[model samples]
Target: MTAITAPMAHRTRLRLTARGRRLLTAVAALPAAIALAFAVVSGGAALATIDDGAPAQSFATVTVSAGDTLWSIAEDIAPTADPRDVVDAIVRLNALDGAQISAGQSLAIPAEYAP
Candidate 1:
């Protein structure tokens, strides 16, 4: 008769169980979630940054009335601006050859200026 022998089971100290595998997966996913949130929050901020300071504001359009001069209009558009510069802007805006005034003519006034 042949002798019967049972196979021996080997032990491993570094083996991972199901729980350890689940823990590893969770740890890996945490950073991905945080990175996704960061991307969502920060995406639009750079686009809004100063493209040479946010494209200066849209110029204001005004209907000229009697007694209104280029100096007055420029002051109204940008009170802090130098009068000469304002005059130049107004001249360029309206394409005027001279400082002539008329009623009911519309002119574009620039606002929120920077050099």
Candidate 2:
């Protein structure tokens, strides 16, 4: 019988090559580049919404009288404009909880609708 000899096992080691290192670097930088691009795009879009030629709007004061309602006030102030829009603006300007108003109360009206 011939003598049998055991073969030595070769050990394998993991090493990152130049191509692998470059790929890893690119992957790490991808999110930062995307975030920068998104910020720039959103900033530009926000700046575009501003209108330089539009006139500045102003407000005026109105004293609430007996039997006065928001709908009636809006119509009287801005008959040419939309009553619903005017009422909404009045509500927002006064920071009122509802359309309820009392006598001797002061309210702010848009200058365009002021008499």
Instruction: Give the alpha-carbon lDDT of every model.
Output: 0.75, 0.85
What lDDT is reached at residue 68 by model 2? 96
Most accurate candidate by TM-score: 2
Q: RMSD to native for every prediction?
A: 14.3, 8.7
Q: Which stretches of candidate 1 lie over 4 Å from their true place?
A: 1-57, 111-115
lDDT of 2 by residue, 12-105 (tens): 9999999999999999999999877976989755444454422245678899999999999999998899999999999987789998999999
Instruction: Residues 50-115, candidate 1: write the lDDT tens digits.
Output: 344333365667888889988887777677879889889778766799999688998776554422
- Pairs with steric clashes in candidate 1: none
- The parts of candidate 2 lying over 4 Å away from their true place are 1-57
Cα error of candidate 2 at position 5, Å:
36
Clashes of 1: 0
